[model samples]
Target: MPGIAVRTAAVLLVTVGDGTSFPTAAHLASYAGLAPTTKSSGTSIHGEHAPRGGNRQLKRAMFLSAFAALHDPASHTYYDHCRTRGKTHTQALLRLARQRINVLFAMLRDGTFYEPRTPRLT
Candidate 1:
């Protein structure tokens, strides 16, 4: 109302986009610039970098959401999986954001809100 980061607003906006039960998690992630960037040249090359273009506020919101994902067993497990697979903190967070996007997509498509399903520990 008074003052809030644009990222926060973006997340909320995406969550409520169109009111058709679709929030465009994928769109939100891309908008936030949380997606990875790749650069290659004749010789020199950069593997990946934080995305170059997107809404900074959305990026900040997604990053902030990463912390919350860390504490959730389901989300944390996925987050750990990304890290274990050789992703850095930033990379892992991006992966988590992507995962979150998928979840949101599914929810929107199915008309369901998040209800994390945790796998049984073996």
Candidate 2:
């Protein structure tokens, strides 16, 4: 079999907890600094969602999450839905991120773990 790409959950699992142990995506996103950052420069304008301000490894994880959501069939379907709702790639990714955040939240809230049966990066 061809070599499979690495993944965020795998990394998180190794570092923190596996997919079985749920951790909020927001917690992960915040930990990764993928979450928005507020910065106002005297109303002039020079701001980004705060560039790279969290765990380097965890940030990588969110990108992996983004990539996975883009690739996974179910996630792709959701992305298409976002696109149909007039969301751009970035917008779609944000939407996907929001959804991922929910999944993570639910998993953690329920004290359930994520057990991906398929070779999923999603």
Candidate 3:
């Protein structure tokens, strides 16, 4: 939600409607084309690749949000973790977007707003 401007949020609301429509976050990601497509052939695994079909506007919103989230401490840490794992910049961003979708899904299910961090007590 950090990177989601009003316009983007509006677009997402219009395109995605109710999050409950999706059984899970993964389903929502697939609907938005954030999930990878499998490519296996001839008894060999060609590996997974970006999906070719999904709601373009939703995907765009997620991608942009992920990009903007880099400024967030947690998001920055996750992005760096992906980079350390040898994920390319684009791959890391996509991973971030997917993670965000999962969080969004939970938030919608619980009717909660984004929280930057959990409270801690000593």
Candidate 4:
């Protein structure tokens, strides 16, 4: 929600339509091309990678939103965690986009406003 301003929110709303088409957040992620796909061959297997298919416009919007959201503390923390885990910048951003999809789905499904989560004190 931090990165999603007027234009970005418009793009998402237009792209997602009525939102009932997707039964779950995973469905939305897959439709937006944020879902990873595994490639494998005989006696060989490759790691999961983002698929080339799905709605390119939506995917681009999601990626840009994730990048813009880096300034947010929670998003920054998650991005840093992903980087520390050996994820490249792009990979980390993609993961962030995928993660945000869950929140977006919930908001859309429940017709609720975005509420930032408070940091828990350990």
Q: Estimate each model's TM-score.
A: 0.64, 0.56, 0.89, 0.90
Error of 1 at 52 (Å): 1.8
| Model 3, position 109: C-alpha lDDT score | 85
Count clashing residue pairs per candidate: 1, 3, 0, 0
Across residues 16-60, which tens digit of lDDT does each residue of candidate 1 receive? 463354256556556667656678898888897777798765566
Candidate 4 total steric clashes:
0
User: For model 4, what is the alpha-carbon lDDT of residue 120?
Assistant: 40
Expressed as tens digits, the lDDT of each residue in 1-122 for candidate 3 is: 78899988998899878687999999999999999989988899988899989999999899999999899988888888889999999999998899889888889888999988732212
Q: Which predicted model would earn the best lDDT?
A: 4
Cα lDDT of candidate 3 equals 0.88
| lDDT at position 87, candidate 1 | 81
By TM-score, the best candidate is 4
- Candidate 4 deviant stretches above 4 angstroms: 40-45, 118-122
Better of 1 and 4 by lDDT: 4
Whole-model lDDT per candidate: 0.63, 0.59, 0.88, 0.92
Where model 2 places Cα greater than 4 Å from the true spot, the runs are 1-7, 14-25, 41-50, 85-87, 114-122
Q: Which digits, one per residue and each the tens of the lDDT, describe model 4 over residues 50-117?
A: 79999999999999999999999988888888899999999999999998999899999999998989
